[model samples]
Target: MNNIVVKEDVNLPALPNTVLPAISELTAALGIPRDALASHEEIEYAWRDLPRELREIPSELRGELIARMCVAVSVGLFDGAMNYIWNAAILQLRQKIRNFSLAVVAQIQQNDFEEKHLRDLQDSRLLGLCLKLNIIDEDGFFFLDQCREVRNNFSAAHPTMGTVNDREFTTFLNRCVRYALADSSSPKGVEISAFISAIKGARFIDNQRQIWVQRLTSTHDAQRQLLVNMAHAVYCDSATAEPARLNAIDLCNGLSTAFTSSIKADLINTHCEYIAKGLEEKHTASLQFFERLGLLGLLDESEQHVIFSRAINRLWDVHNGMNNFHNEPPFAERLLELSHQGAVPETIQDSFVQTIVCCRIGNGYGVSNAAVCYYDELIKGFSPREVTDLILAAKDRTSNLGRRIAGVGSCKRNFKTVLNLIDTASVPNLVRADYDNFVR
Candidate 1:
């Protein structure tokens, strides 16, 4: 299925009377339950069908044919009225004999997929529609095949931004899908959630961040709320040590950039259920933002304990950090950091374990915390120089996994951690060796 289809036309169809009710009825028939704000105009605009001659066609007359075909496909998807309009449109197209180009017909037939995946990640409507049309096998594997790219794309995220919020995002997404199919509600929510879900599946590391930035910059409150949920979800779901750490960092960084004083913390606390979880880090991205404002002192003694306690549990493997820690030294180091940072106890370790697992089988994301662990083990088999070279090589590879490897404030924090880790006798001797080499 071509995710990318560009229409090349030289003519326009005489504009048909804009029939909005017919469009909505047809959308209903197509199994779309709801749309936040989809209307006749939007339908016509987004359909990718040749409009009733937005421009005049030359001798080719392709515009008239495509316009007719658009009505026909709409009728077909919508059924009763769709059948009527489609039959009439086909007749009209036939009457316009000069327009019966085989190439144009083929293109129209292929493009019967105007409302494809709509997720905007990989133009997968072709795959989904082909499966539905019986042009392609709709066997057990079809859904699997259709979303292979999407799955692959999502799998690339680090587990620390575990699929938790992604799962919730998916749930909300499914709710929107239900609305698109059966709810007959506004298209607004559906569009927003779809945007978030698709953005989560995008190739860029900072796509979600950009969305939040856009939400903040835009005057639209709904878009702002949608992005807020998404940002929170990223923080709430992550499983890997580093990405999760950075998500927590980014939330604070983002908050600092946007809000001030207790208002910032108030906003985070008000909307984010995971705010307590995030603050547990103690080492937040906006420590300066809070510190300079004196909001830092608002954190009480117990709050600090819970945060550090949870980190300690994630760091449990680190207590035995000397010899066997080398088996998963990075894990131990990360755990140690998390532990030292503080969190509640390790009472829910089983539930937390799944958050760290890879979403799909054999999915390898190099910039992921998982990849860091994988590399740590792989480097054990190499010479120190080779390991140093590999680390340098990786520096140029893989995106930030939803968090920059270094940020202005976060970099200084990481530097502090590196210094501490290097000085700490409990860590592997090779850790300091790697750090010294990394800076050089």
Candidate 2:
């Protein structure tokens, strides 16, 4: 998409010529794409010439450049608070972040032990550093987890479901800050792709990643790998590994204690679209990721219940949040597989019942309103004709007292029902496109 680079004139740290040259050298050794370790002479040219180009670039190119920079920084090529910024991540892939942070502290000469602003910034930086080294600080990650869960409850605080493209991600962050500070019992929230995407494209452009998403989708030359990676990571867990079930239970109970305490974000098309592709491609590893974590004793009883409740209470949120509506056919097939296997957690039953309620008669799941999104996405995979048959299947299976069962029949029927009811706008892609993969 012709991603433009941004050159920040901020009084941020600059890499030494030796450091800059090392980028090309390492890249040459590893044979990374578009990489060449800068020579001392090459560093001069890049630092001098690259900065000028970055300054004058148009908005469209900014997203591409910003994304590239994120990769660069992670690899130890680029460093620190550039005039530009990116979406932050908890994905730990680097091994020298601790070392990098030490370097950063010295380079920036940032000092302020008591100021909240600086503390937050440094904490964020430290988090990034820890991730690089794969040194996952359990306490700190839990802290982040707390922030997410607490903040997600604020969705009820919103007037709609899922997020709207309106405020972009500012609403999510602002609320997270408040939730974290207010001390809600809700567990920390998990991030959707938008969260990471926002961090990736936040700085350097006014339109943010909106323009970038468009460019990538519009291109015949777009890297399919990036799209695929984006989809794969979308609903992936944002939690830190807990020691055993006890810790997980603590987290679950901690978050569960606050179930009737939230709101929704307005659902937007772009957000939904990205979410769909990701959820569609969410591999067996991802779903199993949670289940395995649960069985590992890394998840607690409370957490199990909460997870179930969420599954029951927010199946729609599960689908919508994960952007399942735009997902490909394989996603539906995968859902069917998960449902058929005895491996599907009993914990998710409560939520599955909720899904039946939402899609069956448009009513109760003890959750007030059903998370309709889930019902919709699963059903969307089917055609209108198939949907009607599914609806019949759902209606036939309703309990005498009227609770929906969580079985292959129910799942398949519900999937059909959801699709049948979905309006055209609800589906993000008319003719689906392959989610592109990237070097995550």
Span of 10 residues, lowest total lDDT, candidate 1: 353-362
lDDT of 1 by residue, 180-211 (tens): 11111111112344444544443435767665
For each candidate, C-alpha RMSD in Å?
Answer: 24.9, 24.9
Instruction: Flag regions of model 2 displaced more than 4 Å.
Output: 1-305, 314-354, 357-360, 363-374, 381-440
